[model samples]
Target: MQIILNGAATEVADALTMAELIEQLKLGGRRLAVEVNAELVPRSRFSEHRLAPQDQVEIIHAVGGG
Candidate 1:
């Protein structure tokens, strides 16, 4: 399956959930935000939100600086 990740074409497994994607990208347990097809997916729903092919995904990580 293919999805547009952060404005770039990317390949991913079919039936992939948001949580799985996060882990695949090595982003699990990090402070982050995810949006799919212009809709925001809450962290609580990451496990349940399944991504579809051609879906637009945006992942933003929170960086700490002081």
Candidate 2:
């Protein structure tokens, strides 16, 4: 399926959930926040949130600064 990820066009396998997508993208253990279709998806609900075609996915990773 095709989805917009971080403002870029991305194509991923079918029937992927947020959790699966994270793992698929190797984002495990990273401090990040996810927004789908202008809605914030809680970390706990990652496994439950299924992605659909043309969904907007924004993953913001934390950065350290002094």
Candidate 3:
């Protein structure tokens, strides 16, 4: 399946869930926010949110400031 992740086109396995995607993206830290198709997805729901073709996923990571 094809989906747009963080403004890039990516091909992933069929029936991949958000949790899988997160791991694939190497976002194991807790300082990132995930938004799927314009909606904020909670961390607890990552495994339950299944991704479809052309799905838009925005992952934003936070940075420490002085």
For all candidates, the clash counts are: 0, 0, 0
Indicate the worst ten consecutive residues by lDDT in candidate 1: 32-41
The CA-based lDDT of model 1 is what? 0.96
Candidate 1 residue 10 C-alpha distance from true site, Å: 0.7
- Clash-forming residue pairs, model 2: none
> Each model's C-alpha lDDT?
0.96, 0.93, 0.90
Top of the candidates by lDDT: 1
TM per prediction: 0.94, 0.90, 0.89
For 1-66, candidate 1 gives per-residue lDDT tens digits of 999999999999999999999999999999998999999999999999999999999999999999
Candidate 1 vs. true structure, TM-score: 0.94
- Per-residue lDDT value at 42 in model 3: 91
- Pull out the clashing pairs in model 3: none
Q: Which segments of model 2 are wrong by more than 4 Å?
A: none
**Which residue pairs in candidate 1 collide?**
none
